[model samples]
Target: MSHTANKDALAQGTHHLIIDGIEQYYHVMGEGPVCIVHSGGPGVRWDYLRMPLIEAFLKLIYLEPIGTGASGRLADPRGYTLARYTRHVDALIDHLAVGTVYFLGHSHGGFVGLRYALDHLQRLSGLILYDTSPTTGPEFGQSIEEALQRFAARHSIRPEVPKLLAAVRRVFAAEAQAAATDEDATRELQQIFPVYFADYWGREREFAPLRESVWAWSDPLRGQEPEPYDVRGELGRIAARTLVLAGQEDAICVPSWAQVLHAGLPVSQLVVLPHSGHFGHLEEPHAFASAVRNFVS
Candidate 1:
């Protein structure tokens, strides 16, 4: 289906939370048990994945972490520690008065979700990991450094809004086109790219106020430093039921990471979606949403 069609498939709503003196943004839709969706990067906004699945979910909550998107940027980089982030989740839950919730994290968000489970397992009904890793392996650490360097270089250029939007459109279109050949694939690529691109640009605009802190938080990682986390030792401590999903073609967070995550979580199931990449939710929305509904139910 086209991106528009996919979006049309979703029922959405908006809400906000104030935690640690920052206005944390979130979108809420559906009703039942609450399910909070966390973004992959500490910097990525939550809009990319907030959609009709909310209709199927009891409730879907999308949060933009502090120092990114609509949340206030902290002058102190030390304030960006992982523990502080987990606390942000805590604050949001408390602010919303949500007694219990299902935690869904993509990429880095997955790590954060697991960390939350470690500390607040009683608050979670289950855990959903999308294209995420339990820990950053040696090879993954090197890759993260490379990616940070690339982001640093891009930050230096500081491309204008138009240029950034155009670039996003071109890159996603090229990738989607390269990945699928069927007419349905082409139509979906054309439709979804713009919607995703628009959401990305919306985040870019919302992110303008916090560019400095965002860049600062990302700068050190460009150099040789151990990755920010080592959660492998603590995975088994996660007491919540977990479902792990990996894209068949995700080069960044490879499928093996999902396998590793599954092995660590005693109550976890793994699913690998064929012909999909890092953004499996977008690549296979129906399947993605179905898997989530099944597990969440």
Candidate 2:
């Protein structure tokens, strides 16, 4: 299927950037305070966050990370790291001629946004982290299990734990073992949405139709990570005021990571939205938008 474009998006138009003979894409909307919103996936596009109320809170500048959406792919491919993504945003800010801006990076986008803020604190007014963790490791351990256990409080673990866990692990191993490890494998991970949402079983169908617009071939980056893969050490360097948003039920970027981020940053606030999953912006739009508006105000 062709990627869906929001042609009727209120007051919005597609934009582009060309560097190193590679063209990149980003969408701009609204006329409020400037806020750049980066979507999840080191490989996925920003198609999922185009809600109406988001525009009401702030001017939304949706950046299409290189190799995804309508953007050009890097020739080296190794340049697909979070640091490269940070540079993409850097160029956008200069190209657009913006003074100070607010950045809202969701999931992997949050990883990029965090890196960008730490390096260019002077140009940022605030940082908004949603459904993202500072680093990767045990901190992101089987979030599906964590999400389930959250629902069954007094219990140490969910009764269906063994089978559910084995199944999730099998999928991960299968993807890793595949003959080809590409962004399309990241696309296949979408089929396992049950592990991503608060109530995947109940809302499985509602989640199916919504698919990734573009799946860039960048999983090679997911595999070449440092041992601990933890960025807690650098969180203190994020001088920009920060807002950490977590879905109390999000298994992907669990709320515990949010707490860690809150504790690390010199100045930050944590808000765990109730009954939300990784996609809290979509699951609870009004509340998410309000939190963003208040924080940036």
Candidate 3:
């Protein structure tokens, strides 16, 4: 089927698509070749990655994963598996008839993008991984704990916050094992979202733009990643010109994981955002957009 925009000429510039009987929404911005962007969030909003700077260099197609933004809700949380998301992207690619798209995914979206390249490498011309990991090991979890502890030692974070942090991880682990969605789990995630930024409290305004945007959470896909996300063995399967961007202080995806993720891709360049966290693109928009522009051009 042709992309929804084709259904009506008036629909041009509107970001919406019908995938698998549900109407899904994705924003289309800028001009030139398409660079499909997958926003982070097993259920996060796509508005965060709408970087005009990058759009100036390459056309950007941002996807709203199920349960968030204008996308349809999944009937079954179990359907939120990594493979399922990869397929959603595949269907979107076909539905749009945009050949050999340049895929860019952030956080969880990066995982899906990497998976897509592994099986459908022929359909991808290049790949961009922003603040993501190749695998989720006990080490990554431990590192987050350690970082929190270290941060506490210096900043004296509220005592109750630590308990909340533990609860956050528990919620994540539980949902991952069950492969389901829970609004309660999502609330817990938003509660400790600050841990994602280098200066969550101090640099509050830096995230102001997103403050007004609708940040929705779905319990199905992200938390329900059935297995430990270990794509290390399959990294070599990606053959596109890959650009790996990591935040130097990213506690969640961590720079160390990015280092190894970069090392595994045969053709890849790693750019560590010297002073940013998971939302490195926001923290360093100019540099971030320039990196993307330089790579694609």
Candidate 4:
């Protein structure tokens, strides 16, 4: 099919493309410059990353990364890696026939976006590193442990705090993840959903529906985990303008990480949402949308 025809089909609704002998799924919304969004979890459904406000100014293509949602799962679950994810993004951009589009990656998706920007710089007009870091493993793990302690301390009096902490712990437990069904993962995600927001309990009326609806899938890693990621030295190489976004109270991807990204990237800006945690897009939609629009425009 022609490039124009391909773009038209993408904007209409859900679409799939055969990439690397597997089905790759994506959805499109809005009507301007193409901005491909990659969601977090490495296994979370893409629905959570939908940016209606940003969509108002830029055509948003939400990618269902390989091994997530209805996208094809790997023959060897260990086969899911940043390299493979980057390749898929490259393929999707090529398939779209939209030259030099914007790229936004959240959480684990941000990891993929970083690698993609480094490896495929020419294809991106801009990069949005939303609630992500340049490295993971020991440093990232330590940060999470510390953040959780703070989160626990902050809500110590709340009866549900202990339960939420336990659920978060189980969610990260290797065995639990390996054995988790969609229902199990989704339940755990819902249980610990409050930690992802700065004030989930305070704003329960507004956020309850999303908290109840969010879902996740465990990464199918049968002892083949990706190598510890660190790209601080390589940040200088990426010339594409970047927007490093973080939430003030984000327990996982902390603000320090965003600071590192902002400091390292040669041409980049950082925006910290005061009233948000990990999910700033949902926590502060208008602010998130404005930052994105101004940067892209």
Candidate 5:
């Protein structure tokens, strides 16, 4: 389909195509070089990654991704792996007929983007790894734990800090067991969202809507891969120029993780949004958009 057709399809809500016997839905906005965006969460909904600012300068293609939002579910939710997500990206590029597009991934979506780039480097013009890390295991967990401790310490004065921290523990525990239901995951994610911000309480008026609006589901297979997710050894192979964006105070994907990615990727730039957390695109929209715009341009 042509770019015009893609826009028209998005105008109605979202555009989708059948890939590997499943529906792959995506949202397109703005106009310029086509940039395909993959939101985070093995189960989090895609709305949280919407970049209206970046849309002003690029044709943003946001994937709903399998097992999320309006997209088709897998026969087994555990089937939502990076490989599967990468295949959908490959197909989406082919379906869009926009060869060598810019690819952006946030959080878990960054993992998907990295897999796609490593597997299909020839199909990409550039890559943006936002709020993501190069690996997930003990080290990553340690960093997150440290970050969370800092967050708790920083916000300890607030009456709600303890509950938020409790929710974080509960969610992580549930994720480890792959036992959370969609409703349960969604509620826990919302309750603990303040931990994701540099100052969510300070800016509750601006960020609360996103906290309340967040949605998630459980993927029984998630985090159960035989091997821990690590691509440090493979990062050298990705020749596409990359923008490694991170939030300075991000608890989940800390600046240290972004630094690791920046150090590994040969041709890359690192931009850490100073006053933001995991959701820099929302907390520091202008900086996030400018970094992306400059990188793509």
Candidate 6:
């Protein structure tokens, strides 16, 4: 669809539902077959995926689970367990009166979506997994720790928040100054680029909200112990048509996990995008949207 057409098609709505005494926030847009898009982090804001996927699906439902985004934070970390997350999704579906929906999940959201398929098979029309795994092993956890350590080391050289904010301001200021010199560059750099970058950077800033909310719900579980969440056994029981999409460059979830998920689902198809990473939808929007549209259709 054209940009204007898509913009005109968008409709926004919100609903508050309580699950286990914790209020969760959910947003609905467009109108058609229901498709619920889950965020990557157990705590990531749903807004991160809103523009790309919501525009494509049009009739999409973006859910911010309890203790995430606009949702109320939970005091107990025990309530943030996988089982409880699954129950929250069920409650949202019940509240929406949606008998069945196409469940689209990314990263951590993919794990929650997998659990939903296992526990409530009858409620799903189809399943779309983007860079997610059914179960995470010890090696996976170790790899993540290593990556985070590397990231910390890289950012440690900088002066922290002020430095980062200064950099953003400098770039935007440069663009604005350039726009003052030439009308074309003004429109391209100042008007276009700044708006895009601001929106993108704003989403990154929202990660703090995500982390804090999840911490609120999961703090009590910290330093306690790690428990196994095995969804491998239940994979074969999933009856919904499944679409597994993976990015070739995704280091975290890895492409192999998508292959494993495809192998496990009784009726499923797998598509691996080239030159793409964990955020395949953002990295390759046309291909990602086309793959999902074709599979779900």
Range of the 10 consecutive residues with the lowest summed lDDT in candidate 2: 1-10
What TM-score does candidate 6 reach?
Answer: 0.69
Candidates arranged by lDDT, highest first:
4, 5, 3, 2, 6, 1
Candidate 5 lDDT tens digits, 120-196 = 99989999999999998788877887898989888888998887777777665524565457887787778788888
Query: Which residue pairs in candidate 5 have backbone atoms (N, alpha carbon, C) closer than 3 angstroms, thus clashing?
Result: none
lDDT measured at residue 207 in model 6 versus the true structure, 0 to 100: 37
Compared with the true structure, the alpha-carbon lDDT of candidate 6 equals 0.64
Regions more than 4 Å wrong, model 2:
1-11, 142-167, 170-187, 211-228
For candidate 1, lDDT tens digit of each residue in 174-288?
Answer: 2322222223333333332322211233345543333322221231112222345778888888878999998765645777788989999889988888756567776667888
Which of the two, 1 or 4, has more TM-score? 4
Span of ten consecutive residues with least summed lDDT in model 1: 214-223
The true-versus-predicted C-alpha distance at residue 101 of model 4, in Å, is 0.7
Which residue pairs of candidate 6 clash?
A: 77-217, 179-186
Task: Give a tens-digit lDDT track for model 6, residues 1-297.
Answer: 111222322346776667777888778776667788888645444765764554555478788766566787666544566777778888767766656778888887898889899888888899999888877666555544453343334445444534443433443341333222223322232222211121223355643333233221222122111467667778999978999998775645667788889999999999998756566676577888899888867
Deviating ranges (above 4 Å) for candidate 6: 1-11, 51-54, 142-226
The models' CA-based lDDT, in order, is: 0.63, 0.72, 0.75, 0.85, 0.85, 0.64
lDDT of 5: 0.85
Residue runs of model 3 more than 4 Å from their true location after superposition: 1-12, 157-164, 173-186, 208-214, 221-226
Give stretches of model 4 more than 4 Å off: 1-5, 173-177, 219-226
lDDT of 6 at 116: 90
Instruction: Kindly report which residue pairs in candidate 2 clash with one another.
Output: none
State residue 141's C-alpha deviation in candidate 3, in Å: 1.8
Query: How far does residue 156 in candidate 6 sit from its true spot (Å)?
Result: 18
Q: Candidate 4, residues 1-297: lDDT per residue as tens digits?
A: 234536454665899898889899999998888899999886788998988898888988999988778898878778788888888998888888877889999998999899999998988899999999998757776787788888988878889888888877666653454635767767767878899988788889998998888877666333253566899889999899999999989997989999999999999999999989999999999999999988998
TM-score of 3: 0.86
